[model samples]
Target: MSSRASAPTPPPSSPDTGALPMVQPAPSGSSPQGLALGLSAYVIWGLVLPLYVTALAPAGAVEIVVVRIGFSLLFCLVLLAVLRRLGELREALRTPSRWGATALASGLIAVNWLLYALSVVSGNVLQASLGYFMNPLVNVLLGVLLLGERLRRAQWAAVTLAAVAVLGMTVALGAVPWLSLGLAFSFGLYGLVKKRLPTPGHPVTGMTAETLVLTPVFVVGTVLLHGAGQLTTLTEGAGHFWLMAASGVLTAGPLILFSAAARHLSLTTLGLMQYVAPLGQFLVAVLVLGEHMAPARWAGFALIWASLALFTLDQARQARLRRRARRALTGSQAHA
Candidate 1:
């Protein structure tokens, strides 16, 4: 449930090209700064966000998501104006394809946000954390299914392990973990849509457009909730009001930091760093939230962790090979 809201990186294609595509590595002096920013973003998502959502006591999940979207849209617009990026947003939207993609991405992300909020408020933080843990594997599956991408053997094995974990959990729990699957798949599809944007523009701009597309629906819902005496923002006291308003900052701040991190870090580093959020969530769920980890669930999580280890190792090995190849090519060119 942590804000998988970071700017989307395009997924890798078949192994004939490479197992994982490498973005430019962090500049020699900038890696530390990038690491810090990335860590901060993920920590806020994993550690801070669950606690923040739980504090919104009087508000239900729907209301929280509504307020989040509205405030997030407002915050994003202000950012566009202040950064003078409104024109860029306009240009991106001018393309019909981009607008459609943005709209779809908006819907997908809203589902993800709503599901995450529901999970946190319902004492299902452990499930939410599991979803995020499953997300990267879900992304790889999505790449293969939707993007016609081929997976390496290690990737396939990792994916199979994740599948086995899910199946085991379903059998043990006597019901499918639909919440976790919904969260994983929705965010994965959202990333896919964002990656497909013909004109992705700036991360903030894309966020603004997505929110703008959905703001009207949320606005109508807010009005309906108020009429039904369900909207609690104002009557819930000044503390609640501020917390509700702060959703905007909580939503957008990490996104900006993530975008900055992406600029300085290689895709490999960023990919590995993504686990920080889920790991934090896992700790918070068990320690702070006091969610029980049944033995079956523990086994499921162990499988997932093992799968992620395999996936990460494969990617790291590929990245090292790429770097060495680049170095050799540079040396040869210099000698020639």
Candidate 2:
């Protein structure tokens, strides 16, 4: 919920691929717990971020991001120790290729967090929602362009509709929605690189490694910001200081929750839950934040929502077909 909205990597197949593969369902033993944790994480991300924007007032986005990175690394280190996973971190460090990959991923995620913080600080939470809403579609394009994945007709139509929506938004705002686009693309690419990394299931270790890579820069930058009178956490009194310090938990808690959820939920269920964050952001922007949405902007949002409907339906249909096929094959082989 810290606006470091994490996207799990896209499947090797485009989500819009005509023949979507079956995603395994959650194990019964853990489904309830996973659903609870995942929902909590998503809700915090979507709803709590706006509040943090207010709390982080007087602190520029860059300073907040620096604190977030520094404290998150500390939190991750603690979790690693408690979980007895320091060996995983050591193993990752020993591999030179992983070092490079994690370094790159660190930069990408930091960029993502910075951009998201900037949008929120600028009172553009509505745009942030739009960006996340466009994220899955962006992943489709990334898969096609980067991974040589093919998109079916439905997928193409969805992308086209999204384009039209972007055009509408541009007209409504008298400029392009760069903040939205930046968030979508940055997070999309982050997920892509993280997927290719050697780290498999150790989210804590992987994140710790990435943050460790960024720690020095953030540490030095914080000092420079303080010297320049740009940093505000200390002068802001105990209340503000604690809130700033809480960035560690704000940044790391949801990730741990998400990792727990991933182990016990189907990709489909998780996909559905993914929208909760954006939807909450959208509501907060309009209702609580009082960001006005002109008719044109509303029309654009409606179109994007429609496009998502088509995309989700296509994915569901393909998954069902794959499941039936697998069942039939299994039955025939059993008889044989």
Candidate 3:
């Protein structure tokens, strides 16, 4: 599909009282390319598990995030220049509230990343993958609670299945898989926070602000370490340096993909497809990386998948019903 010259006017920062209710702009229709790009972003993210574990082992999680965020900011600068979105960048920054909310998102995301990286490096990759598997259900709960979205009969059944799945996993493990759960919940909440924020020029602008929130700690931490000759950059291993740079680019690239994809796909479809990352991550963790799993663990994963299938089917049904309702309303108005 051809790109529109200008994006729709964004959502207002604050809603008014006793006036017309505000609506956030919906994504473009049937943008296959955008969906594909979004999936690809997660796909890249999913497939990089082993690399992240290996790359981050030497330096540590905080250091990795420091490098990732700083370099990612640089990467975004270059991309912004290439896309000629500097004007957009300027606007996003000018809106102090946008940047402030973005800074909050950044803090949330940083916590999520730290949890995930720690999980991966500490041989809990499989568990981390499981947390992501459960995340969609969490999002659904958020929709109901936070967005006032409702579920139909099938949707409710899906929720029940997801609960059972999480229960099964907890039972099988003899302990809650907290690392995975923490990552899932934190990241899902990050999305929610970002969702509530006014639309900025680019999705990454939030990440920029997020990074800014931690910049002082990140900078001072790295410097203090470097002063003691503890910085990984001093290792003189070209491979480590390259991975550090790649991490920065990798961090921002898929976000760019998803943002572009967001321009084209409906929110529901995008939300559903967001699972691709975890699926890819799960496969890589189990098959390629050879993360150990017991039969019970397998059972847990199976239940989770079963729950997701139920949820996904329900979502499809709702979409169909919505479409039919829309058509009926149009037809009735035409006859009148």
Task: For residues 1-336, write the lDDT of model 2, one tens digit per residue.
Answer: 333222233542211001112234463244788789878877877888767765699998898888888888888889889999998888887878888887887787788788788888889888889988898889888877887667777887888999999998898779999988998888878777766666434667777888888988788989999999988888889988889888878777776667667678776777777788889899999999899999888999999999989878777666677779999999999999
Q: What TM-score should be assigned to candidate 2? A: 0.90
Off by over 4 Å in 3: 1-36, 144-150, 199-201, 227-229, 263-269
Displacement of residue 226 (Cα, Å) in model 2 is 0.9
Off by over 4 Å in 2: 1-30
Candidate 3 C-alpha error for residue 87, in Å: 3.9
The models' CA-based lDDT, in order, is: 0.78, 0.77, 0.65
Q: What TM-score goes with each of the models?
A: 0.90, 0.90, 0.82
lDDT winner: 1
lDDT of 1: 0.78
Question: After superposition, which runs of candidate 1 have C-alpha atoms over 4 Å from their true positions?
Answer: 1-30
lDDT of 1 by residue, 1-336 (tens): 232221223342110000011234453334788889878888888899989999999799999988888888888889889999889878878878888887887788888888899999999988888898888888888877886677778888999999999999999989898888998888877776665656354667777777788888788989999999999997889999999999888887877777677678877777777888888889999999899999999999999999999988887777677779999999999999
Write one digit per residue (lDDT tens) for candidate 3, span 196-250. Answer: 7753534555455455556676788789878877688658588878877777667
